[model samples]
Target: MNWRRLQAVMVKELRQMRRDRITLAMIVAIPVMQLLLFGYAINTNLRDLTAGIADQANTAGSRALVMDIVATTVVTPTLAAETPQQLMEAMRRGEISIGIVIPPDFERRRIEGRERVQILVDGSDNAVQSAAAQLAQMPLDAPVRTGPAIERAISVVAFYNPERRSAVNIVPGLIGVILTMTMVLFTGVAIVRERERGNMELLIATPVSSAELMIGKVLPYVAIGLVQTSVVLALGLWLFQVPLNGSVLHVYIAAMLLIVANLTLGLLISTRAQSQFQAMQMTFFIFLPSILLSGFMFPFAGMPRPVQWLAEVLPLTHFLRLIRGVMLRGASLWELWVDVLALLAFTVAMMTLAISRFRKRLD
Candidate 1:
């Protein structure tokens, strides 16, 4: 090959790249996005986990113990629970990660060398479970008789997964992660593929409106999403022995919401993308952050406030909570209605955007 011909072709390709703003933007944006996500957003050390406190003794000793625990910064006591029942309720609602309970006979039990403090942990998340375990092992210093400090005894009790099995947590989250990976990717290329394959004319020749066409295009993929969900759940139950303590119906309902939300988002990206490559880039743009920030691989309670707010916007984040609540905690959909509502709202918004932006006429 001639050097001149190779240089000429390279220049032609560079010109084409300059004209494609989305591709250009992605080249710059993705690295910065990754840097920000890894540097600031993603945290695995697990700090500031939301905690609830039930100080029954209400004495100086009980308060000092509580202070010592908080000083460790492994968990932050954000809720004031009057009783252990209230603490369980908060953990049940996903409001707190763990509960700190000081018994009424805390000091008395200390004298008798019995357990005084109980740490109730939401064990659905392995990271949070690890944090709870770390907190349990912490030796909080309290002057027993004004001499050298005596170590405070903390008892740890895990709520959902007593065994703390990795599969128990990973399998449920894998459902959401798989759907987000497939459903968005499949439909992200759907409309663009039509244009690339010269099917736009056939579609436009039909009497269907843009909204009708968009809905029809995504319907088949919805079934595919469910099939994937069933396969994962079945394997989880069969191989991993993952528990289905809650209603399977609740799991399906939650899965359906997430499936539709992801499909709509893919369609939205399809409308904006000029080609299958552009669509894939945009899908990755959404997919990467969803995986990182949606509590799929990390504890939601451990993230900073801004990161948590950003995570709350992702469909997977809410779905993770819903699926885990149903499959592990035996929680009904009604009990986790807040996350359900967020998913519903996301699906509707993405649907509206995809339809309104999609033009029946070719670009």
Candidate 2:
């Protein structure tokens, strides 16, 4: 069986593996990252969901019931309203996932033994809707009693996406996912390939500075990213029937910012990676968390505080909010300035890192 030859070959391979520091690091890092991200960050049991309270009753009983709902920890009331109309508007704007409307006669009806309280849910996000439904059932089976005379009856309503269609929530997120995946991979490989082909040294010998070289590499990808965004949006709208309720200009601006951020990230990775394979591995490492912790597949609020903090730093996390806000809620750029600024900051930071890391001379 040539056992000696096989052992020699195995030893040679292990020596090569040890020399490739990036690959070695990936071997140790990817599994640990997967364990932490999936075990700690990915959660389906939704909690601390943003909710609105429309307390028309304005009575002690209504207030007590709201407190009870909050105590359950299933939803956290963040907005207050005087009527159901306001609550519905909040849900439509993606401000809250759950809305409680205590009618004017709610206290009277409860005392009379026929209390009805409306619970409105944003059905676009299936996970939030499912968790809300389960929580709503808790009060329905046995109403929350504020006093001996008060007994509540819950009427649950699913808004925006009454059908709880997965497509409605996923299509908008897919735009960010596609852009991140394509932009990062394309530019990361492009720069690495240039280095591998000795083109980087040729360019370095010329008058081109590192910053100029980086900009030259990234500029073409910006055009490519825009074309990709347009095609994806067009297809998503036509095939999935994804609604774009906001100004298309906002979407375009957000998309461009997201694209630049990812492209710069690719350039940064390429600067650190010696080979295209290492660049791809780096991209995958970033891409995994982007998909999992960015609230693309799961509810962002469901994750723990530490995990949410990690998510906040991810470019995809902010872009997802921007895309969903514009497409689902008709949110204006002014309303989403925080997310817009986050993306802008990411773009600038990544570009700066890439430029500073890229050396004109080969090591």
Candidate 3:
């Protein structure tokens, strides 16, 4: 309660903060970054969703219907699929968000006064699904009227997550979010704690190289990551009844790659941080963006193009795709190779950077 003592303590803390550039930068950068990310990147209004068209009708009426959907701007029909199966396959691979299947009888149905077309949406993303449904409900003007009494309507069907259950979509994504949070937090503190305890010098005095030391520290966490992934997957299946349609092995492989990437990123952060607290702060700096910008909460396509590009570089983004593809869509390895390769590249790059930055002797 002494005024002079409180003033002295406050001044001491201010001086300490001034000396830690990383902490100071974080204090200033975090709020500004959050404002920009949430303001510019996060959007609920879905637009330009990649659409696949399976025009089995192959008639003028079907073509006109496709154009009408495109004009709505809710879905862009960029892909032409030869069959309904092909359109569904594109959705499974996350190549397109909407699929329009014009049956061969579509024109005939219109002529007979019972015209209906199917609009399949990737319901894994609830926002996109809702928007697509609204767009589909909008009445379309028939290009060729076979009869004055005939009516045209579009039926919206949700695939992969028919009921539009939030758990069905969110639980698989939680796998990536959980891995990113735990892997980064655990490994971020490891090396800094060792250095703080003066064990780093002892290790350096030994013959172990920097890469060997880094890998040694990271190897144990890989097992921990696998255990965490399995537990989450089991709970999601049991509690949420989330389907695991693809091979479990593919999910395991993708989880392993994602874990390694995040762990290596943690190691890199630990090398830069002078204390465990700084390591934790750096982890938060990475964590916030990973969760917000990585399509965990918001649809990736809904974000601005630059933010979408940023999401593409985050490990969580690719892992989400992999987990969702395997769990919901039953996508095979070949279909998810792009995401796998992205995770692999990130892991290797982060591993190399962490080793190169790790010093044999403590500063």
lDDT of every predicted structure (CA atoms)? 0.89, 0.84, 0.86
> Which candidate do you rate higher for lDDT, 2 or 3?
3
Query: How high is the lDDT of residue 157 in model 3?
Result: 85
lDDT of 2 by residue, 281-350 (tens): 9999999999999999888989999999999999999998888778777778777788889988988999
Assess candidate 2 and give its TM-score to the true structure: 0.92
Worst 10 residues of 1 by lDDT: 143-152
- 205, model 2: CA deviation in Å? 2.0
C-alpha positional error of residue 325 in candidate 3 after TM-score superposition, expressed in Å: 0.4
Best by TM-score: 1
lDDT of 3 by residue, 1-363 (tens): 999999999999999999999999998999999998889999878888999999898887767666767766778778999898999889999898899888888867776766556888888778778887777656555443333321245778898888889999999899899999999999999889998899888898899998998899889999999999999999999999998999999899989989999999999998999999999999999999999988889878789888899889999999988888888889886798999899889989998999999888777
Model 3 CA lDDT for position 214: 87
lDDT of 1 by residue, 1-363 (tens): 899999999999999999999999999999999999888888888888889999999988778778877877888879998899999988887888889999898878777777778999999998888888877775554434311233347779999998999999999999999999999999999999999999998988989998898899889998999999999999999999999988988899999999999999999999999999999999999999999999988667667789899999999999999999999888888989999999999999998999999887787
